[model samples]
Target chain A: MTALLERVYAWRWSVLPPITGVAMMAMIVGALVAAPREIIEGEVQRLMYLHVPAAIIMYVAFFFTAFASVMLLWKRDIRWDAAARASAIVGVFLCGIVLVTGAIWGKPIWGVYWSWDARLTSTLILFLIYCAYLLARSVAGPLDEQAARYAAIFAIIGVADIPIIQMSVRWWRTLHPQPIVFRPDPALPNEMLVVLLIGFVAVLSLATWLISLQTDTERAAQRVSALRAEFDHREIA
Target chain B: MNVLGAVVAKDLKLAWRNRSGWLSAAAFSTIAVLTYSFAFDLATGDVRPLLPGVIWTTFLFAGVFAAGQSFQDEVDDGTFDALMFSPVGATSVFAGKLVANLIALLIIEFSQLILATILFDVALLTPELLGIVLIGTIGYVSLTTLLATMGGHVRGRSVLLPVLSLPLLIPLLIGAVRATGASLGLEAGTGPWMLLLMVFAVWATLAAVLLFPTAAEQ
Candidate 1:
């Protein structure tokens, strides 16, 4: 079992990219060509295939960031900090995608690029919170323990705020459409559901690959900094 | 318990002695209200519909200013280091700061209420409105106090404090506005909004209790 796990770990970098690329290509075909067009909104509805999956990925990335943050605080492990930082960066990037695509979809349907509706506003706020998280990390200087702690604390607070924000905004306005994908009886027909499922797998795998690459880069950067510090101390001695 | 009281008393006393801190916050809120009144042309319209948003926004700005000043001042003057060296735990320090900030925010809210009543020609001192103000202020101050501590000693804290805290305070903002509107008869069904405000207050306080030690410890 250990040997198998090691082999898989070694092959992940080489295996993941091609698989993700293929899955992504399949998703694009499924979304554009395979799914039936809506009677009211034709091609614009296809944006849902990308929009919903990206939103899911963004939420998952932030959730992972918050989980890793809790571990960092409790275990004092720099690895967890790197994981948290990488996840947050990915989460922020995906959130931007979700917002921009949402705006594009909204333009034809809502007749405007943006609305002060509940889900849109809450997602925007989420984006701002994580962007501020990255800003706080940068401002606190590089890899400082206190900075890590602060980011961890802030991420936890932001996650905790998510439910309340959703509830309040839902009450504040109801312009956004209801969920069609995750219901007990999903509103989508069979064909669209298949495309959505494919999109989900493709996006999730892509996010995983990006987060892994980012975490590795952070770890490498930390190693270089440590080595440079060691060389400086030896020279001084 | 004694330590908590001492910390609260110390913060309150310091705020009182250095009156400019919260005083400036109050002045800022008042000026903002005046500016909004002019901008919205309060004389020609029924400003009742707009009063809830104005009141809440002003209170939010004031609360952020006071919370940031209270923490950053301690860090700047090195008093936070001395306090950390003392026998007090982080919870006491956090709870104390929270209470002090709560009182300061309440004062600002009440003053803003009066200013709105006079400027917007709306009676805002009703029982329901008062209760909403109290609960909303508690949540707002609780959240800002935590973020202010986290942002303290970091560069560009003046920018960091609001950016960090405001997104988290959206629920409070929404709840307060709707509840206030309900109480003032511009909207209906205050129950859900008030419940949201109460839940947010409790969650913020609990989170601060759990996280303050990690933030405050050296």
Candidate 2:
């Protein structure tokens, strides 16, 4: 376990730019091809190419939190907790992009910048919740490993709410559209399908690059924070 | 019957004598209610519809506000170590802390409900809505009180409590909001809401019972 752990950190950061570049190029071309030129409402759905992929990426980001939360509880692994923290930073960025693009999309369609629909509300709540998690990480500031530990416990418990947050829309009569999740459309016309697939891959590759960078930064920061604390203690003594 | 009661009583004594401790919770509840009223005023004319949701949210936050002081001062003052050596089951200590926090929250909840009615002009103060609020409050308070104790041991505990508590409170929020929405004359069937409330209560109580000792030890 120790040997494998050593190798994992060794490779956490050296592997993503090229991957994301290729993915990004693919995404640009895919978007151009799929951009709706003439429809009842055109070009606004252009935001869909961006918004849908970003939403999916946020889900991937949250899964990192859930994974870390469980690992911390099960094995008391601080590394997992760090990964969770790292993911949250990335998750927030993705969630913010989703909200922004969503607002842009809504302007052309709903004639407003925002709505209190369930998805919107839940997404906002989800963003706030993770932001709360990040803020908790900052509260103890540098040199407080306790904050990370507490944040880990929080990450574990907080993920349990996502389902409820997601369901709260349909559970009650909320303005949010019902999830198209359960009933699968038998066939997507190839154009939409291809665009969505390419879009997901592109967003996912970028999310990976960002998540890796985040994890590296968190761990490095933790190290610097601990050293600073040690120096402070020596000076005080 | 043991030092649990003594510790509970001790923490309450500590908080009450501080003056700020007592008012911090009251102030939060009040501000929460005010903000809630103003936010609702923007959209809907009837504060009655949103009253119970606002009250429960206010109390949940109030509980979070007050619960972290659990053994915080005791820990800081170095009195907590001695408490551990005293003749009390950690469970009793937890119970006492949890109870004291609950008392503080209840006071805030009651005051907020009254002030909300008077201020928001929610004239229809039904016994039924109040009853639903009472049940919802119990479930929300117990979970928060316990979680606060657990999180309080961490550094930046003040920030830690809400991070942990809010997610756990989602089910309670749903039950409360749905129940409150129903109480406000929506078609909320009694059967489902009550079941949701009970589930939350049971889950929260069990966690508190199990972890009270851990919190005490921490």
How many residue pairs clash (N, CA or C atoms closer than 3 angstroms) in each of the candidate models, in the order given?
0, 0
Question: Tell me, what's the RMSD of every candidate?
Answer: 2.2, 4.5
What is the Å distance of residue B162 in model 2 from its true position? 6.1
Q: Each model's TM-score?
A: 0.94, 0.79
Tens digits of per-residue lDDT for model 2, B44-102: 56566566577777777777777656666777777766767777766776677667776
TM-scores of chain A, one for each prediction:
0.94, 0.86
Residues B1-218, candidate 1, lDDT per residue (tens digit)? 88899999998987888879888999999998888888888767688888889889888987887787767778878888788777887788888888888888788889888878876678898888999999998888877887777646566788778888888888899999999999999988899999999999999899988998888765
Q: Interface root mean square deviation of every model, in Å?
A: 1.3, 4.0
Predicted structure with the largest lDDT when compared to the true one: 1
Question: Local error of candidate 1 at A173, Å?
Answer: 1.7
For all candidates in order, the CA lDDT equals: 0.87, 0.70
CA lDDT of A188 in candidate 1?
89
What class would a CAPRI assessor give candidate 2's docking?
acceptable
Worst 10 residues of 1 chain B by lDDT: B147-156
